[model samples]
Target: MDNFAHLFQGFAIAFTPVNLLTALVGAFMGIVVGAMPGIGSLAGCSLLLPLTFHMDPTAGIIMLAGVYYGNMYGGAFSAILLNIPGDAPAVMTAIDGYAMTKRRKAGKALFAANLASFIGGTIGILILTGLAPTLAALGLKFGPAEMVSLLLLAFTSIGWMMGDDPKYGLISTFLGAMLALIGMDPVNGQIRFTGGNINLYSGLTFIPIVIGMFGFSQVIEMVTNRMSFHFLGGEKLSIKGSLLNREEVKGILPNALRSGVLGCFVGILPGAGATIASFISYMTGKRVSKKGEQFGEGVVEGIACSEAANNAAAAGAFAPLLSLGLPGSGTAAVLLGGLMMWGLQPGPRLFTEQADFCWSLIASMYIGNIICILIAIAVIPFLTKILKVPAGIMAPIIMTLCVVGSYAANNNIFDVYVMIAAGFIGYFLNKNKYPIAPLLLAFVLTGTLEKNFSQAFKINGGSPSIFFTKPISLGLLIFMVLFITVPMVMKKVKASKNTGDQPG
Candidate 1:
């Protein structure tokens, strides 16, 4: 009852004319950013952070949250209409979505993506509302050992759940850990791997690394391919025509809901984000679908699973920001910086000290997501026409935007170089069926995992059993073991059954 009262109050605040208008504007801008290749919610939020300085903290947060989810809705437009994904999470969407477009069911695919996003986003918001406080309370009980165990669980989940090869996932994770060790040591105050370079003293900046990995890498790939342009194809979409038939709608709902739930769970974990969510969702949707072999061949279930998970992950990414003063994903990290800039600390203290701001932020998620749905529905037809643009014209524009976006991320040319390098790496990896999600997850989790692990060891006098001593830590370890073990067992069983079915 008290929660309901607080939510009602939050809605009252969020619905104010000024806040509503800010959310609308944020959503509109988010769509534009998401439609553009190489731009993402993190960049969109970062660009808008300075603007928030002039507004009330609550209103500012509302607008920021709107942009976060709105970008997700907008990301689907390009993923479906064109082969390019505007954001990492949308990559899975492009696989089947673009295939569907080529089959002349672009409108149907767009509708499914939109509807799935709406459902996933709404569910995630509701889960956030109901579960955040509980998670915050739990976070208060975390000691160094518990935190370390949790980090281990995150890494294990990411490694086990993503990628075609677990070995490559482990390699990516170790590489990220190495990168995190480049700066001054947290315990000894000694420079570890800076090579006496002044810029290395601060270690690699997150903004530069992310821009290089996602933004620059793409440009290099485009140049190497000598691609003139990428394009989409579809007539102007009609909402009525876009609506899925009974069979199509029914076929995708289960996968969408499942992916939404899975994405939300993953998103709440620090260091796991929409990329992992989408990857896992796509794989799982394929495993469960009756037409699993048709996954990359324009299956509606594929689109639903990927889009639903990514959007839900976007919503779930806020959990750590609100509850623990920890950012779950890159965009959430940027939002954390924005909060600090506003003189508003996140975590449990913020919940009590800035109750209205916190509640209003949550409420605005629901409102903003609904608004994004309406906006996407209204704008998708116009946006879909970009597919018809000749590839010759589109290629150069994409390359230019990719370079500009990478440079803009940190205003550093070094980042552009890094992006190009990462892109070459990504392109080759993609060709070889090496999954990128595990690499990304490894990069994101290494720092926190190492810090917490070292801290926990120091507290426990180097006793590995410390993790098993705490109930929460023990529970998490057990969960991780089960999660990893079960999949292997299932795979073995399936293989055995298949072998048995074959003639001797």
Candidate 2:
């Protein structure tokens, strides 16, 4: 009853004219950012971090949160119309969405995506409201040993989920972990990898690294290739039917709900984001749907599965951040960093210490999604035409934002150089097919992981078995082992079967 009362109070706060206006503006900006290929929510939020310095913490957080989930809805636009994913999470959406576009059912694709995204976002918010506090209660039981085990689990999960070869994932994680160790030691005041540079003492800036990799690198790639986008036969956008007929809606609702649930669970795990959730949900939908074979060729359920799961995962990624002060994805890490910038530490205490702010933020998500859905539907005609913006015209804009965002992050010229260096290196890494997720995710977790590891050792008086002795830690360790090992085992089995079939 008290919780319900607090929730009502949250609604009161969210419904205020000032807050309502902020939500609308944030949603609009997020949609624009998400629809642009290079400026994902990560870069978008990073670039906008400076804006929060001037506003109330609650209002600032509410706006940023709106941008976070709003991107999920907006990303499907580019995926469907251009076959170019606006962000990593939209990659799966393009598989079916673009196919629908090619077949001239672009309106139906947009309709399916909009409905799925809305359902997923709304359900995810409800689930978060009911489950976050419980998860926070569970997180309270974790000590240093458990935390170390949890980090290990995150590493294993990302490594196994990334691609066909887990080696690339492992390599990416190692590289990130190593980069994370460049700053002063967390336990002691001594710096380990600074190489005598004064700037290194503060460590590599997150904003520059991400801007270089996702923002600058992409623009460089497009310019180098002289990329050009053209619709088939120069066909203009057209849709003949209503947005969603009764039959299509009935066919999609169940799968959208199922994918949302699946995505929420995946999101709760540290580092598993929309990309992984959408792929997993799409595969699951393929296995169960009667029109499974038709999935990649304009199937409505494919759009539902991908869009719903990704949107749900976006909301789900907030759980660990809010409840445990742990980020589940790269964008969440940025948001977590933003929280720190405001002189507010993230963790369970936030719920009690800033109940009004927390609850209002939660309530605003409901409002934001409704706003995002309305805009997404109303702008389909214009949205579909965004692909017409030539790469030549877009390149300079992306480059400018990347540089400006990097400079503003630290107000340092050296960081701009670092961004340029990172961009070139990122391009090289991309050519080699290295997965970037593990690196970014690992970097975000490294400091905390190291801190917990050292603390656990001290608490156990150097007894390593302390990790295995704790029930939760032991279970997490076992899970990590299995997760890392199963892929290798499966590969071996497949190789053996292929060899046996070759000549015998």
Candidate 3:
């Protein structure tokens, strides 16, 4: 009852005209930034981080939260329309989303993505509201050893789940780990692979690398392949036609709900971000759905699971941020910096000392979530028009956006060069049919894995027994082992049975 009363007070604060306007503007800008390939929530929020400095801390945070939510909703746009992920989390969405686009179901795909995003965001927020303190406490139990085990499990599962030939996935995984190791060592602060160039000291920036790989590489393919510029059967695009039938809505609800719950849990875990959540949920949907075998061949369930998990993870991330002062993802890290800038110290003290501020931020999320969906739905008709642009015109436009987004990350000319090089590398890799997901997964998790492994070793005085002794770490290791071996064993058993059935 007290919580409800406080929430009502929060609603009162959030209903203010200034706060409402800020949320609207933030959501709009986030959608725009996220829709543009290569400019993800991290870059979008970083660019806008300065704007919040001049406003009230509560209102400012509300706006940034709006952006965070809106970005999750918008990231699917490019993935569905252009077959290029606007951000890392949208990578899984592109597989089926682009398939849907090719089938002239872009409007339906967009609607489903938005609907699932809303459901997931709502679930995450509700969980955060009721269990922020408890979830934070649970997360605090994940020490260095546990984190290392969990990340290893993530890497192994990602590699195993990606491609038909597991070898390709493993190769991509190793390559990503190698690329991640090029920068400075987290434990020793010593550089490893930075040759002679000073720019190499900081290693590579993610934004430039991603823009080059996904965005620029795509531009290369467009020009080289001379692909058709316009989408087929886009003659009568309208809002009414985009509405999901009752059956489609029913199909999305269960997947979205399941993914929402799963995403919240993943989001609470340290270093497991929305990208991983989306991947895991999409894979889970594949295993459970009756049409699992048709996942990448244009399935609404795939979009529902991926988009829901990512958005839910985005909202669930706030639990750790507010209660434990920990950032759940890269974008959350930026938000952490903002929290400090606002003269607020997160943790138990925050809820006690700044209850109004915290509650107001929570209240604003509900409004922002609604505003984002409504805004996104309204813009669908406009966004779908991107499919009608000519190839020649779209090609140059995407290239320019790629360059601008990469340069904007750090205002560095060197990043542009890196982007171009990565583009060529990505193009070559794609030509060879290499699975990119494992490489990306390894690249993101390797650094975190290294840091935790170092920390665990330091804590245990170089004894490897620490990992085995910790209950959580041991459990995760067991799970990882089972996850790897069980499938292979089952495949062998099935193969033997088929061989025995052959006529003599």
The total number of steric clashes, by the backbone 3 Å criterion, in model 1 comes to: 7
Candidate 2 residue 460 Cα shift, in angstroms, is 2.0
For each candidate, C-alpha RMSD in Å? Answer: 4.4, 6.3, 2.2
Tell me how far the alpha carbon of residue 178 in candidate 1 is from the true structure, in angstroms, after superposition.
5.8
Tens-digit per-residue lDDT, 1-504, candidate 1: 666678889999999999999999888888888876657788888888888888888888888888888888877776777555677677778778867876767888888888888888887887788888675444456676776776676567655544567776666656556776787776667888877876667565443444344444444554566533242333555667777899988878898899888888767766667877877777678666776658778989999888889889888888778878988788999989889888988987777788888888888888899899899888766766665776555556655765675676566776666566666676666666665555655555566667777888888899888899889889988977886798799989999999999999
Could you tell me the lDDT of residue 127 within candidate 2? Answer: 79
Judged by whole-model lDDT over C-alpha atoms, candidate 1 comes out at 0.75
Q: Which of 2 and 3 is ahead in lDDT?
A: 3
Lowest lDDT 10-residue stretch of candidate 2: 227-236
Off-target runs (Cα >4 Å) in candidate 1 are: 37-39, 76-109, 139-242, 265-306, 313-358, 482-487, 490-504
Top TM-score: which candidate number?
A: 3
List TM-scores for all candidates, in order. 0.79, 0.69, 0.93
lDDT of 2 at 113: 93
